[model samples]
Target: MELITNLPVLAAILATFLLAGLVKGVIGLGLPTIAMGLLGMVIAPAEAAALLVLPSLVTNIWQLMDGPKLGPLLRRLAPMQVAVAVGTLLGLWAGLLPGKGGATAGLGAALLAYAAFGLLPLRLPQVPPRAEAWAGPLVGLLTGLVTAATGVFVLPAVPYLQALGLERDRLVQALGISFTVSTLGLAAGLASGGGFGGGALGGSVLALLPALAGMALGGRLRGLVSASTFRRCFFLGLLILGAHLLWQGLH
Candidate 1:
């Protein structure tokens, strides 16, 4: 990959992944979101997406296996996972993904929405047990579409997950499960679009080192920092980044 050969870009990639992983380690999420948003400013979103696959997949898998309630979570969330895969593939088929030039705007829109959602004190109604059947698939489908377009998968999915009223540990595990599926779906979509070649895959593998390192560092620092304050700063940064990307795309 030219990105690997280019010293400056390679450095950027390493730094970005390190920071992204740190965020995830501290907050239990935001690796993809932070990585994609930052990298998109420096490269094509498609390339950024390609480089995200391995680190995201590996981390999410680690996260997914950490909790003991996998069986029950899978049973409850299986339909949503399937729908996520289908919707991602369908979005790719419809050419809604990043390489198309319009995707920067799509990504910007997604970031703006996500950051706003995080920053706002919006309370979503709790989803009843009976509503899971219909609600899960619907949210998954929407999340998949956003993922396909932006290479970031935290929108309706996160909001919907929060509304499910799961216990704290179960909620974290559920996020891991959902993100793992989304990452896989995104990988499939990227491969089909010729974006996930050997070079990209290699870069992704290399990127994992920094990501893991950052996660470790962040894990140690988690107790030292206030999560709520850090999260506010994170969302503010995303809001600014989103505005810049939106302007860049429009021009």
Candidate 2:
């Protein structure tokens, strides 16, 4: 409540969510990516991540629930999720937000990688069933490390899921499942670090309204636009943002 009364912080929170939700609604991903990348510019990465907890969890749950075959998907993804949870805790213990410079630099490098992948057509080799046990844990560990440091988890997680040879819809649902677990794991990490102060908690809850509203608008917009082209523009913008974060961190 007190923080919301501060116009600048409130405005930043609103804009962050509106844009994040719009991205997710259109592309079915990037909510946390945008929120952390943009919000961390104005606030601490830990606080930015903390503010994402509720909305990210809720929206991803919505995504996870849409597909009917959650049971099989859940079973297949269990090891990955467990590894993510454990790895997130370990990464946090290792210094979740290291320092402003270090965190921003790490995030910048990650965003650069993410943006580059966005431009390329990534064709991952299929993971054989026999390899999933080892492969899944490796990807989960990487995702958790990124989430702990950068507040983004798309790197190995999404690409790994993409390589699993699942159908399109199943891939979407699997991403949702992974994101949901990441959100919860992130929340736990933030709580452990005392990032969930009153203002941060309130900002997270209040940001949900704009997030939902933007999602609704974006959903409507999806029908009227070419999403593939839109995604290209989104990636370009992310590239610029990544460059800025890198500059800020290095300087």
Candidate 3:
């Protein structure tokens, strides 16, 4: 729309989507994390988030559709479902807070930092039952908060999942399900907060094309890339994005 018609901004959005899609296609996750980071630089964090919702839905839906072995996926993640939901709600509430520009940037910075550290591939020993009990709620809370604030919920969970050595299929399924649930929650929360007006909603729809194009290309190129390579690219991209965010915030 007119809001994003600036040639430079349009190019940046498309380029962000193209790279984000490729990352997701090859690695099973990273669409929001990458796209939001780049787009956030070009626009408000909320606008970046608005831009991401449809694409996140589209890409995750595609992932959920193709993913098999649902039973195992559910079983492995069952313990945390409630936590995810709860965390998502909390995040929604957080999003509704006033003076959100600073909060959104702060949340984005935290997410970027988490993703950056996760690049080191840290792992905890077999998690204790009590830890597992608490982990879900904590991660869910952070995920939801991130969703509400910046339209991204990959933090903490994405890295934790990777650390757990999840197979590609399970990783994709888990993220897809999580994103779907949380995004719906976010949509509801944003609607309640009077966040998605006519122009923003229109922009959100327009943003979906780049997201879809990115994911489609990623899907096609999936076989050509190694997981580690993709992960490295994702992590490094986050590092750059995170630094950029911090610089933007400081200035």
> Which candidate should be chosen as best, given TM-score against the real structure?
1
For 1-251, candidate 1 gives per-residue lDDT tens digits of 79899999999999999999898888888999889888998888889999999999998887789888699899999998888888888887788777576788877888898899999999799999999999999999998888888888888788899899988778878889999999999999899888899999999999999999988888888899998999999999999988888888888
Name the Cα RMSD for model 3: 2.8
Candidate of highest lDDT: 1
Give each prediction's root-mean-square deviation over alpha carbons.
Answer: 1.0, 1.6, 2.8
Give the runs in model 1 whose Cα sits over 4 Å from its true position: none
After superposing candidate 3, which stretches have Cα over 4 Å from the reference?
75-79, 94-101, 104-108, 128-131, 163-165
Encode model 2's per-residue lDDT on 1-251: one tens digit a residue: 35567789779989989999988887888898899898888777777887888889888898889888699889999999998877777888788653444898888888888888888887879999999999999999889888888888787898889889998778878999999998888888777887777777887888888888877788789878898899899999889989898888888
Q: Which candidate, 2 or 3, would have the higher TM-score against the true structure? A: 2
Query: Could you tell me every candidate's TM-score relative to the true structure?
Result: 0.97, 0.94, 0.84
**Candidate 2: pairs in clash:** none
- CA lDDT of 173 in candidate 3? 83
**Which 10 consecutive positions of candidate 3 have the poorest summed lDDT?**
95-104
| Cα TM-score of candidate 3 | 0.84
